[model samples]
Target: MQAFDNNLTSVIKSLKSSYGLAFFNNLTLQLHQLINADYTFIAKIDKERYISQTISLVAKGKIGDNFEYSLNDTPCADVSDDSVCIYPERICQLYPNDQLLIDMKIEGYLGTPLHDSNGEVIGLIVALYESTIINSEKIVALFELFSGRISAEIEREDKEKKLTELNLSLEDKVNERTTELSSALDRLRFTQDKLIEQEKMASLGNLVAGVAHEINTPLGVAVLCGSNIEDALEKLNSKVKSNSLKKSELEHLISILNQSEKSLSFNLTRAANLVDNFKEMAVGINTDDLMSINVHLWLNSLIGSLRPMLHKKSITIELLVDKNPPNFITCPAKMSQVITNIISNSAAHAFEANDDISDHQVIISAKVCSDILSIKISDNGKGMTDEVKDNIFEPFYTTKRGEGGTGLGLSIVHNLIINNLSGKLEVESTVGQGTSFNLEFPSLI
Candidate 1:
């Protein structure tokens, strides 16, 4: 009993300080010396495969290397099933066909099953001798005492290995997902920029088409008047060449010439005025430079250029500017784009629900108060609901998504007003009443 207690204390001390095959071999060696056994081993048993792996082995008073063998016809297999097995003096009487036992001349055998926390047999500890063991019970007791500790160590190592593999797998998945999300965000930004560029081009195309349409009328009139004047001059030259001129005939020719001159001059002046307005609009839309501009004069020219487009929709636009509104020093191109997007948006959406074309009106009024410039553009058409108003400025959000509305018009307008022009924009609307956009900006930016 004293020897058994001392052996247990020594094994516990060694196990607490060290680990791995060396620790297991040292433990088996200590057990072998204590019992005076010729052979001692600790084996892990795979019950399903009927295999035993020798974790630590000792023989002939020396430590032996670990190995594995079939457990089909071995005493270790029986020890795995039963808690303890002892063969004090077998002498080839039991399991005579067991070649390992015959070859090693092992007569005395004692083993204890190593059980895990769940009380399931997982391994065995065994001792064998060339002669019969005088104290078989003591050997079995010693094997049983340390079997649980060995099982615990094996289970702990297995769990730690699985946990390490799981942690590595989790980290890999997290990194992969993060990379995918970053790539997706980059793609989204690229697509957004492309869409914005497309919207700008489309707006410019519309403006060009409108200006072309507006210029056609006066140009046509001027051409007609010039043709008539040329025909009248040719007839007068023929009369002078013939040397047959009456006073009444000369007076009639002069009256006809006077009317033709006035018609030609009026039509030419109209054409020139239209051309000037279009030129100003084109310059404003293309240039980004900041310049001092008369608020009233600029608005008048912009409205004149847009009249052709408004007329096509049967929409009337009225502009009321203060007598002494302060001039603004800012980028006219960006402001023009902002205003154009707003009016275009109204023409496309605000009047779609209203059937009355006679009353369709867009009123633009501007005033200067202290250092601020305020512009109000209001429409007398079906207004918006709270939901539409809230998300109106959000990119890619629109009510007319399918019918050629890119939903970027208002988003561009908002960005231009806030980001480029450094101005503020607000909208007021009720479902049945009307819609009004209020714009305010510094006189100098």
Candidate 2:
């Protein structure tokens, strides 16, 4: 046992400073010298083909080229069959068909099968001599000691190769998934843009509809006044033809004609003003058409145009400003849009649960201090939660989801104020108290 330990320790040290193939080659050389053999070699078996391939070879202390050969009728055949085989001398005589042994003039042979971690025969180690193998038991001990080391190297290489293949497969899968996601994102963006443009066109349609709806009242009144005048004139013609017209009756007829004329003039003028206001609000809405405006007068007209919608719901909207407010420079179309959307938002969303008509009121007021014009639109109706207020300015955000609410009204207002008009908008709300929007812009644009 002591001799065996000394031999094992010396053998391990000889190959300890090397790795992989170098370690294998060094071990073969060391084994060749340690046992004083003419030839030393290590070979792996191809079980399916019944063949042996040398990984390391040595002849008389010199490393030589490795080669492959059939394992049939050779001493290595028994070794690969999981047996330690030794012929003390005349190995060629024992097996005549082993041509390599005869050519090398080999007389003795000693070999042992190498086992993997599972103890399955994988390979063999061999030493040959021209003379009888002396100290055969010592050589057997040396081979047995180091067979595990070589087997471990082979197992490690197998694991590393498998890991590399797995990594390459994983990388390919990740790249393919990334490409799929990128394509999906592009399609989603295109669809979203199309939807937004459609909504914008729908909003314009609604604007035209609101204007037409509001104008109906005054135009209907004008038609009624014209009919009244025609009826009065028919009566006057008959009275004149008969020459029975009294002075008092003639005076009353004059008064009636004058009143009908004035009423007709007033309502027609009102319809024209509504048309002008609609044209002002909707024209150049997509462009930066900047101009100066009288704060109070502009607010009053814009509110008047929006009144039909509010009055339809019995909601009253009022404008408040200093009597002599300063003129403000801004994009009239964008400012009008911002105010219109806010008032429309209040009318649709606020005052929903309130049963009192008096409580359904919106106040729009404007003022300028230190060249910054601030406009506030507030409603005395159902307000919002903190969560809703936080995301109110985000595009397509709305509490009213499905009942014909596009959720783009306030978002459009936000973009108009910030992107086009170069201004800022802020909001305040409590769940039931009400909501207020403060729109501020530089008085000089």
Candidate 3:
């Protein structure tokens, strides 16, 4: 009894230090020594295939290796059905045709079902001898004790293998998802760059159209005046040929010539001024030249250029400047674009044809407060809802989609003010009352 207890303790200790096949081999060797048997082994049974694998075996004081054989006509087949099988002095009488028993010359046998964690039979622990065995009950009890530990070890190994496989699968999935996200981000950035370039081209086109419209009227007036002066000269030549020119007639001709000269000069000057303003705006758009200029004067000039577009819609713009405005050293061209986009947006969205109101007014007010420049542009037109106001500056979001509105006007303005000028933009609006845009930036004087 003391020997059995010492062997059991050693087996349990070996289970802690060793694992899988090594643990099973050590356990089987110990049990073989304890029982003084000719053979001791542990077999893993496959009930579905009717086969069993010898995981660990010891024979006649020598270590035996692992193997597999059919479970047909074997004592292990009976032990797998949740039962203990012990044949004392069988000597091949019970199963005469059992080839394994006949070859090994087993006279005694003891085996018990090895259950898994869920109490299902998976294998068996068996001890066999060439001679009839005494103390069979003791051997069976000892085998049952160690069998539970063996079952637990097998379960632990299976779980570890499954966990390792799961970790590998999760790692692969994470890497695949990361690669997909990187590709998506690259495509998105490319699309954004293209959209920004398109918006800039659209703004340039609007500027060109406005300048042409404004210059057309003055040029037409100048041409008409020139034609009238030519006719008056022809009449004076005819009078000189006849040599009958009166003083009153000569005075009338002079008066007519003076009026025509004044009209031609005024119109020509107006056309020249329009050309100069357009050239400045074009230069500003194409280059990033910084200059120190009066804020009041610059803003009023930009508004004047945009007036041709606004006037067609009968939209009236009013500019209010501070008493003493500061000069700002900044990129005027970028600022011009920002202001143009904002005012253009209002002109397109803020007004309806109403005979009751004489003016669809846009008021632009500029002030310098505490070294900061504040410009407020407000329109008394149909205002925006809360949702529209919230997403107004988002790229590709527009209230006028499919109506030749690209939705990039305010988005470009926002990017220019915030990124180019290091400034802030905010908006206030009521659904029916009006909308106001407040812009502020540090005046680098």
TM-scores of all candidate predictions against the true structure: 0.79, 0.70, 0.75
| Reference-based lDDT, each prediction | 0.81, 0.83, 0.84
Q: Where is model 3 poorest over a 10-residue stretch in terms of lDDT?
A: 350-359
lDDT (10s digit) by residue, model 1, range 329-401: 7776777777788888778887854476457789999987776778899987789999999999999998998
- Give the number of the best model, judged by TM-score: 1
Q: Which candidate leads in lDDT?
A: 3
What is residue 221's positional error in candidate 3, in angstroms? 3.2
Q: Tell me the deviation in Å of residue 420 in model 2.
A: 4.8
lDDT of 2 by residue, 220-280 (tens): 9999999999998998999999999999989998898999999999999999988887776
Q: Which residue pairs clash in candidate 1? A: none
Candidate 3 Cα misplacement greater than 4 A, ranges: 13-29, 32-111, 126-138, 223-269, 284-288, 294-297, 322-326, 354-358, 368-371, 385-388, 394-397, 400-408
Given candidate 1, what's the lDDT at residue 106? 85
In terms of lDDT, model 2 sits at: 0.83
lDDT of 1: 0.81
Between candidates 1 and 2, the one scoring higher on lDDT is 2
Ranking by TM-score: 1, 3, 2
- Ordered by lDDT, highest first, the candidates read 3, 2, 1
lDDT of 3: 0.84
